[model samples]
Target: MKALILVGGFGTRLRPLTLSVPKPLVDFANKPMILHQIEALKDVGVTEVVLAINYQPEVKASHSQISILQLRLCLLKKASFYFLQVMLNFLKEFETKLGIKITCSQETEPLGTAGPLALARDQLIDGSGDPFFVLNSDVISEYPFEELIQFHKSHGGEGTIMVTKVDEPSKYGVVVMEEETGKVERFVEKPKMFVGNKINAGIYLLNPSVLDRIQLRPTSIEKEVFPQIAADQRLFAMVLPGFWMDIGQPRDYITGLRLYLTSLRKKSPSKLSTGSHIVGNVLVHESAVIGEGCLLGPDVAIGPGCVVECGVRLSRCTVMRGVRIKKHACISNSIIGWHSTVGQWARVENMTILGEDVHVCDEIYSNGGVVLPHKEIKSSILKPEIVM
Candidate 1:
């Protein structure tokens, strides 16, 4: 089977970080965010992936034949495109490492959720007459792809919308399913009143024929297409067990990091950091350098090439690749992004998010501060603010 991932749009909710890089390329658990979805699909027999995007990179002015020799990504709507190139280039390595072929499609204009399926129709549908998966790049879950496939086969529906139970469904597109037949009845998108607790989990398995319901225009699969399928009595529902997280904004992103780490510890303890006195669920990459006397734990992930000096304390934090945490520093409930450095005796906590290449000087204290890439934090930040 094949899968399609929607990786378009400027990620405004995740600004600064997304300002420097595309949302799909952002690191979560030391891997690109979209790779998690790709890996999940691969485990369930997906052989190829289609990355549907709209962000276009332009060539530089001093462009020469040598420019062709090097892959350089320029600005996108005035934002950095270097991360865009990294995203495209990484597909080569992903194809080789994961044993799956990847294809990319760019949209000339903005197309809503269902339009991409129509745009990539030739690649999605063929004589094979099989169903394909559509995934939202933002949602992360312990994917039960096989079970969804089996359920769809038995239910014999044209499409299966994977749903998850959330405490408040009114904020999402609430899906009402027939309790016995598992057939979808209707959808209530951000309903004013209580409709149902089961919400669209942003994952779907649809037969290629369903693509015919969409047009080559801006169309939403939820607000426009899914209703038609439900009216035809062809859309089924599958409620997956375990955790599902929508890691869009900073707060949810940090929460998702903890969820991911805890889940990993349960499934495979070896993936997490080990050794005597390890505090909690931690994933310290093999190449990371941790000095003696550092206390790390209770949901901490040290990415590859990270350096932690002695007496540093990290809790409920994600330290990205090449981050340097000097001696006697403390971090909690925060994310230290790639190539950032925290000076000695600095204390960073309270949901702070430091972007790539940030530098926290000695004795500085930061709390709930969102520091942009390449900024230098020299003083104390006691309140939440954005430093650009």
Candidate 2:
């Protein structure tokens, strides 16, 4: 069946990384974040995908073109397209080389998730009148899409939402389902309290009729459309197996990378160590180097051209391209973005996330803090707080 992916959100919450690149293009597990979603959908027998993109359409177009080219090289080809780039050269190359057709649509203004569905309704629906899957580009789950589809079909549900257990239901669209039948009894938008732990995982198997509920203007599918359907008692819920991590925040983004790396290690022993001891779980791009006397982790990612100096300790840290960690620096549970430099003897700890080109001077200690992209932190210290 076909799938519709909402990738148009500006991703204001994930700044710096999303400043130049769309949120879907942000790297997670050594690949673009949206690639994981696309791959998952493909795993579930989805042959066609419709991307809804708004921010940085040109870059998104180029990235999709490159991905299509790579997929053709690897024989994982399927129908895909960036929402824009109907007139670009890359689209021509994509059409010629991949032998797959791509369609594009533009949103002149901001349209919420469901609004895009309304915009692309004619293109997405086929004559068969079948349901199509809808995905949020930023949510990454290794859940079995095929099984979720089965759950929807067997129960004759108008819509089936993939649900997962979370510690805080208040942060998401919480679902209250009947235990025996998996029927969605109620939909609560970030309720203050909850009796169950199940929450909306942002993955849906939606019937085309749901698209009619979405207005032509900006409207939240979660807040407006889904609740109305749940009230009608037609919504179904499915619990999925395997790991799922939303890459909306810096910490969750880093965690998603680590989780993907771990999954990779299980499939191949020679893969980078999900732990530092194994060569496989650690991914050091060809141009990156780990210096002597450094204790790298069970889960570490050293991006292209990065350098880890002597005596530096990094565990569960992701060092993006061209980052330089000087001698005697100690970093753990953090993510250091591209071209950022850590001063000698600097100490960063406890889930600190440093954006691109961030300079942590010598002896500066930042813990549980976030450093926005291209910012300067010189001769000073920051504590455990949100950096951006």
Candidate 3:
């Protein structure tokens, strides 16, 4: 089987991190975010994976056709090139590592959720009539790809969406389906009133014929294509069994990390860290150095080349590659970006995010501060704010 991941252009929701690295390349639990999905797809016998990325057109003064938004996107031209280069290199490495044929499907114009499928029609359609998987890049879950495919095949529908129960159905696109038949009756996108507890989990298995419903333009699958499929009685849904989260923002990313660690502990306890200094579930990379007397636990992931000094405490956080936490520093509920430094006795908590190469001065305290890249924080941030 084949798969396509909708890796939209410039992940603005995950800024600072996305500014430095592409969203797909951003580290989640010491591994690139897209790697998780790719690995899952590989496990379910997916041979080729297509990354549907948006291509920004160059700015031309003579062209009156360009909109203000397109002009603004042109400003990121250099950065976009860099992102593509990095992504290609990463894909090359993973292709060999995972033994999968991974390729890119670049869209010259902005194509919304469903349009990418139409744009990459040639790559997906191999004349086998086999269903291909479609996934949103930001979503993290214990991917039940095998079961999802089985369910989709059993329903004999053109498309099958994986749905999960959520508390606030109004905040998301709710899927209303027959409990017995799993046939989708309708989709309610952010309805003011309660429709159902189940919401789209951003994963789908669709036949090649489903691509015919989509046009090669800026079109939403949720708003346009799925409704038609449902009306034709060719759309179905399969309930997801485990945890699911769209880690597209900082807060949700941290929350997703905790959920991931908990699931990891149950699935593979041997991978988790264990020692006198450890409190709960913790993941320390083999290259990371943990000094004596440091207390780390309750959902913490220290990436490769990290150094946690003596007396440092960490909980419910992700310390990315090459970060250093000096002696007596305390960090919780936060993300320390790549190669950042937290000085001695410093305290960072409550979703404090330090961008790449950021340095927090000794004896400093920060609460819910989103520090940008290559910055130095000398003063304390008492409240939640962005430090650009």
Candidate 4:
């Protein structure tokens, strides 16, 4: 089987992190974010994975915005080459790392979600009428793909969408599936009233023929394609049994990290750190140097080459690779990105997200701060703010 992974658009929700790299390339645990989805696809007899991307926008330039148009044209000329180079490197690394044949299907103009399928028509079409997998790149989940395929095959539908139950259905695109037949009846995107608990999980097993219905224009699959298919009674829903997280934003990325680690601890306990005072469900990479007398845990991930000094306390934080935490520092609900330095007697807490190569001087205290890359923070931040 083949798969198409949607990786288009600038990830605006995850700024600074997405500013430096694409959302798919952002590190989740120790691996690039999209590797999880690619690995899952590889497990289910999938060989080639096509990345559907929008390299340029479709809008025609207006004379009133000539400067903006000029800037965009310049960026469009350069950005595609840079993106292709990064894609090449990522493809090479992932092929070696995960052993999958990855390829790209770039769109000259921005194609909305669901439009990419029609845009990549020649690449995805097969005469044998086989089904293909389509997934959004931002989701991180314990994808029970084998079971999903089995369910789709038995359901006898043109499409089968993977759905998962959410507590707050109003905030997401809720899927209303008939309990008996498993057929999708309706979709409520951010509904004001109580609709249903199940929401679209951003994964789909789509028949190749489904592309025949889509046009080569900006279109939303959720709003356009899905509703029509549901009305035709050819769309079905398969509720996933395990965990799912949409890690498109910074806060959810941390939450997804916690969920992933929690799941790993159940099936693979050896993957987590093993040492003194390691409080709960922690994953310290093998190369990380954890000092004695440190209290870590309740969902903490210390990446490779990290050095934690004695008497340090960490909880619900991701300390990325090459970070050095000096003595008596405390961190909670934060992310210290790659190669950052937190000094002695420092305290970082309350959802602070520090990008790569940041420095926290000794005795500094940062609370709910968003520090960008390569910055040196020297003062205390009691409230949430961005430190450029």
lDDT of all predictions: 0.86, 0.72, 0.92, 0.86
lDDT (Cα, 0-100) at 281 in candidate 3: 89
lDDT of 3: 0.92
Number of the top-ranking candidate, with lDDT as the measure: 3
Indicate whether candidate 1 or candidate 3 has the larger TM-score. 3
Q: Choose the strongest candidate by TM-score.
A: 3
Query: Which pairs in model 4 have colliding backbones?
Result: none
Model 4 score (lDDT):
0.86
RMSD vs true structure, all candidates: 4.8, 9.0, 2.2, 2.5
Candidate 4 deviation (Cα RMSD):
2.5
Write down the lDDT that model 1 would get: 0.86
lDDT tens digits, residues 248-338, model 2?
8877877877776777666654646333333336776777777776777757788878888888887777887788999999887787877
State the lDDT of candidate 3 residue by residue for 18-89, as single tens digits: 878999999999999999999999999998999998867777665587678777757788778889889988
Per-candidate TM-score against the hidden true structure? 0.92, 0.78, 0.96, 0.93
**lDDT, candidate 1, 266-344, per-residue tens:** 8888888877647978889999999999888888888999999999999988898999999999999998988999999
